[model samples]
Target: MKTYTCQCGTPLFFGNRQCVECGLDAGWCDVCSETAAVSPEGTCVSCGTSVVPCANRTTYDVCNCFVDASLAEPGTLCRSCGMTTMVPDTSLPANVRRWALLEAAKRRLLYDFRTVGYPDDQLTALPPLAFRFLSDTPDKHVVTGHANGVITINTSEADPVHRESTRQQFGEPHRTLIGHMRHETGHFFWMREIEGRRDAEATRLFGDADANPYAETMKQYYEQGPPEDWNEQFISTYAASHPWEDFAETYAFYLDMRAVLDTLRWNAPEQVQDLGDDLPSMLATYCSAGIVLNEINRTMGLTDLVPEVVPPAVVSKLQFVHDVFESLRTGVVSQS
Candidate 1:
């Protein structure tokens, strides 16, 4: 999440469609992890060619990466982008707008995965990752749930009011579209992290993977309340419901730290001008940055953006997860 500057020197964001200062098209090149000047012939560094459309500018309704076009037929969709197991039916009058927003969010999520040096190719290869955006039916599909390997997002998420209501209903102070993306991607990563590695130690730390994740294990607990000591053992109350939820919450917590760290670097480039990949040092830098960030938020009379503090034990766990991600990139652990 390092900052990007347009050719005109204006800052750019990963999802920016245009450079406000220069009137030029802006796009994220997965290979370089930076916003690049995109022309018709522009290509992503990861893919080495323009295989997809500019993710930033999707008016043509195609991938921005341009990697798919080079790997497949002229009009072929990128294998990664084509991994949409399901999309909301745009023909439905009410869904047309929501579906577009979801697509934009999905592309951003995929881009983040790539920016962090994980391959979408490997993720797609696993049971062929797919997504479904559906209209919620009280007796039918749940608003948000993961089954098998597919992720189902509720179309209602597009409505700000509905999302806010759900946040209040759940007693969550911070919830947003991107937060939803981080949480759901955690589920996808759980499959990668736990598959075939379920030893006693791993099981003890995470849980017995054999348990049914969807069953009402926490039915009684919800009726009563989360364990009185939830903060001691669980990442969040939602995580206390199931082992699978715990993993997802932990994974999301890792993503949150990485994102916040990136934001810190972006806000104070001079401070981290020559940073390295050492996790502990980076975390220390973020610790300092967090203090300043929270103080600034307080000055504005805003609540802390990141309220949860990662305890020492959790910090160690997060470092391990980051190592796992690094290993995956180096072929030490094949994401496949």
Candidate 2:
């Protein structure tokens, strides 16, 4: 994402709630499509428009985006917070922090999702898109997944200790709350754009999701593990478990590429100056930038920022993903 400027001429960031230099409040002005200073009464300093700060700021301190004043009521939610249908029980202080972390990740995920031009309207049984942040209970165990347009994420993933342990258990190079959000939304969009719309093409590209028995596939995957040559054809080993997973995994990779490209454009324009819509150019530029980014992380003694290598077969799956996003951009769905 591009940097924003405060009224004080200090640089602001996507997650900034207040300008550190001037102490003036900062908010995401949806109308202006950038973070800007907002008055105490919720006036946009940049555009001189009226907006409503999301209630999550006052109630939970988890949001910084402003809602359009015209569409807002007494306690209106911003576009990002409004989609969160449920959150963890916040009576406990720990739960509140966990909810905060998940909300931050969700906002980032939705920001990138809408940035890619997908509409917020629902194409499934669930009204628009909803999220459920939950913790495991003795009677009801919650696994992170999507169904009928609703995405459920285990609240435990918010804690670094828990997330890193789970990542190592799965032998994942990287696992993150935003990664969970993107991967689950991939399933959400598959239901929206491809389940019945382009099943034939998706089957040819991945496999027949309907033909594969999902539960049995999951069971067998754990027992036998992924094929020894999984990396040759899949973006991740878990992606080789099922066709739906393959699509979601490849779709997540597509989002990761677009996000990195978007970041490079704003923060390092010279690197991606000639990048265009072509897949080859995108892959070339992305891999090129990844090498530099990964090395930078190594210098800091951190995990490689971008670990997965997009292989030839995975490229085919990503081609399918790109087509879906393009269709959404050009066809029925309009950007907000």
Candidate 3:
């Protein structure tokens, strides 16, 4: 993710709602990928559009996106909120905050996608990436995953304590609402962009996409953990469970790497320079950044932010993912 700055020159974050330096309201300009100060009248100077806070923001305080009111009908949502197929019961105060956390993460994910040229409008038009923020009840346990372009996230994951406990239970060093979104959205993209057309290449890199006995596969995975040599090939133990998961995990890592590198470049352009084209060069830059970042985290008494070491095998898979994303961006691969 690139670092954004307010019109007042204060550095802004992806989720920033106000500029600390100037005390002005901030709204994301999708066209320019920057957080610009909104006029008191809620107009976007960059695009000259009459804008308003996204409905999700006004009603639930869950979003920071601004919609172009002239282009959209009355009560229309912004690009990110428009993609939500479901939201938790906001009548409950806890659910309201949980949904807000989920929406914040979702908006960041959408921003990253847009930065890579996969704008929400284009993505929604083709295969339609959507979301469902659900809460588990006595009768229904919400499992987080992607199916048919819809990514479902259990609202419980929004609670840091519960999320940490679940992460520990799964033996995962890194797991967050955004991480889940990135991983599941990886599955959605694979289905939309690569599944049938690039199955041969995907199978060669990950595994057979067609051999999907999902329930039995997952059952076996939980019954007996990943293979002893799993670390040599897969990004994580969960990734080793299935070919599809392997792809998604690797895809998520690719996004993570891209985000870290982009931030590093944005903060220190002269020192970081360009991340090279090849996988090895990119990994080298990422590892260096990870080392510095982990040390900073340690100072704060937090765990290593980017914990997993990328093996050669995983690097190969990342290369494939990067290529696929490039294909998607450039229309090198036919959507049909």
Per TM-score, the best of the predicted structures is: 2
Which pairs clash in model 2? none
What CA root-mean-square deviation does each model show from the true structure?
A: 4.1, 2.7, 2.4
Kindly list the per-residue Cα lDDT of model 1 for residues 1-336, writing each as its tens digit. 666777677887766756787666556554455566555455443335564553323543434443334444454443334655666665676676776576667776665675467765667675756778788665876567665667888888977788888988987756766677778877777776555653443466556757744556767556776788777766677867776777777777767667776665677677666656766776666666667777888899976666666666555555656766777677675232
lDDT of 3 at 279: 61
Error of model 1, residue 150, in angstroms: 1.4
Per-residue C-alpha lDDT of model 3 across residues 104-200, encoded as one tens digit per residue = 8888887678656664455767668889999998899999889888899999999999999999999998879889988998899788877887888
> lDDT per model, in order?
0.64, 0.85, 0.81
TM-score to true structure, per model: 0.81, 0.95, 0.93
| lDDT-sorted candidate list, best first | 2, 3, 1
Indicate the TM-score of model 3. Answer: 0.93
Please identify model 2 stretches exceeding 4 Å from their true place: 122-127, 332-336
Best by lDDT: 2
Residues 1-336, candidate 2, lDDT per residue (tens digit)? Answer: 778898889998989989998888897887777889987777888888888778887788888888778987877888777778888778888888998888888888877876677755543345457899998878988899998889999999998999999999999988999899889999988888888888788899899887889999889999999999999999999999999898888998888888899889888899999998867899899999999999999999999988998889998888878877877777843221
Clashes of 2: 0
